[model samples]
Target: MFNIDLFPQALKSDENGQTRSCLLQQTTMGESVTEQELWFAYPMNLPMPEDDDCDSYLLATLLPAMQLRAAIRVHGSVSHELLANLTELQYVWSKWLPERYFLIDIQVDRIRDQDLQVESAIAAFSGGVDAQFTAYRHATGRAGYATRDIKAGVFVHGFDIPLDDTEGFNSAVEIATQVLSDINVDLLPVKTNVRALWSIDWEEYHAAAIASVLCGLKRYAGIGLIGSGDSYDVLLTPWGSHPITDPLLSCGNFRIIHDGAGFRRSEKLIILSSWSIGIRNLRVCWAGNKHDKNCGHCEKCVRTRLNLLLAGVDNPACFDTPIDSSLFRFMVLKSDAVRIDWSLIRQEIIETGRGLEWLPYIEKVLKRKSSPKLSGLFPFGSKRRMWVKKMLMRNK
Candidate 1:
């Protein structure tokens, strides 16, 4: 069994103005493994979890426990509401990815009492398309009554930007802060080594990680909004951050919402493009250097460019490099998700009678076939293309 022992130490602060909470984790497969300390850091001004608050730890450790096929024993207090939700969470994961994840036992020392109602919310923001859409829609009242009272945008360092990239993180946070500030929202910066410290797969485990981090602010807000990557129409399952699994991560009065699943990426871009601050400062490239802006050559960059062009933004300033039809020759539709994204653009162009010149390039990229291994040569690195193809196809 894996054990996460919450030491009674107060939150620690360093000269760098960062405050962090730590927990000692010990895992046993057959023989005992080495002990490791898991920690999450936030800016000193942000609200953090109490010393004995174990909800975050419980959620953070679930994926690891399932990966090890070992039950978990928590030596701290966890929210009774969260404990109940975890049962359904395990069942869903086990059913979805039986080959890699399994249901595991979870035992807690004591159940933490629930809090009074909390109405404010904080969203997980990476200054990406989905995140901007969630933030803008609610802030601008475009979501109508369904909009949340988003208090701040939580930007994490170690999630997409590496923990070691201080300069890069600072730069990204500056852009995020600017984007959020324009919407009358604050930016809460957090730093963590969760991904670097663990051996778990990131694609399937990222949502839980986001939940764990945001749960730290449960004292300040009752709701956490995780911006949805794909709309409900083209839902991506067996991957991380699905609508079905995101809500299950909620515990006690703190609710987890998978926001912006109702709108397609192009639709979201149209809404955001109308906003001067959001469209001008948008940051979505994942293949470039951590410190650099959009590379304009990656598949994602090209797709975003296409989305902007379709939105009638002839030349968006967010991307320094211009996307041309010649770039599609080097592009590869690695996963069905990528193919679907481009296909949607093609369909939208036909429907709107705009950007028709790029139709041939999009068709060629989707139709051309290549070995999965060849995808490694691309900028964002390689994935199990064939396996993802099968999973998405089967699920659809």
Candidate 2:
């Protein structure tokens, strides 16, 4: 059983004299792990959900991780509607990963009208391709929504960056602030140790974790836009954030919008290429640190650089170094989605008749050559299989 304890909001002033309210959650599970506390400090002047409204907040925030441990052992109570939503989410999880699924038993009391006041829409901003595209579209009213209604961008520290890496968090804040400021949107930096508290897969638990943050701000936002990592055609299974699961995370007050399912990563890059903000501040490095712009050598960095080149927006200023063709010799293309993206990028290069110098290298990278197996009739049997998969991808 897991328990959630909501502490009263505490207003405290930082060294800079800026005041902020600290929203706290203490979660205790039976036997498996020790009690963990999560703190979210928001600007004190901003209107937020009151202590009475914490039931829904806890439901969204604590339930996913708690369900993984034991049944939800609520310290106080939860709403029936949220319980139902969570139960459904658990079902979805079970379908996604049957090995990880378990029945969710809740300690709750039925409550009515637990929804907070509806207000503006906000998108998760991470200075990445998907997030930047979402922010750009929504902020410019291109998403078929009111531009001004989409207000601020939310950046959480613990999701992408390590919780203890204060320097990295500060760096991310700087980039996110600059990116959102260009679109005339406010940037809300949320600090949490939720990842540290629970032993959950980042890919599986991310959507729920992000939904929790947005739900906590129910008094402030009505629609929470989560940037989609995959396109509709190639939605990756076992992914935490998806078009299907993201919308289901919505409750009476908050609606989690999975933005940018229509556009592929390359397409999103093309859209962002025209935007000066994206050109200058686009960050897509998995191996980046507080000190570097982008390592420019990691798989993600290399791919982004290639995409930018294909989009005609490749700039040396945005990346620490030029695309090293040598990296492709050993760089492994692990997932089908990644391989697909690379194939699209290769096609773009061919169609445009540009970047022909890199074609041989790209082909070499895409052609997966596996090692020989002892039981195989043919030498390089796995390599033959890999060749078949590569041919299928090319034909498709």
Highest-scoring model, TM-score: 1
lDDT of 2 by residue, 259-305 (tens): 88988787887888878867677777644444225666667878888
lDDT for every model? Answer: 0.79, 0.67
C-alpha lDDT of residue 365 in model 1 = 86
Give the TM-score of each candidate: 0.90, 0.80
- For residues 1-396, write the lDDT of model 1, one tens digit per residue: 554444424678776554545565565656575666667877666666677777887788888778777777777678888988999999888888898788887877788776654679999998888899999999888988888899999998877776656898899888888889888999998877666666676778899999988998887788999998888888877878999999999998799999999988888988888888888877888656544367677689899999998888877888876667777986787676677788899999999988999989888888887438443332121245334534644552
Question: Which segments of model 2 are wrong by more than 4 Å?
Answer: 1-33, 55-69, 77-81, 114-116, 145-148, 334-337, 347-354, 369-396
Give residue 356's error in model 2 in angstroms.
Answer: 4.0
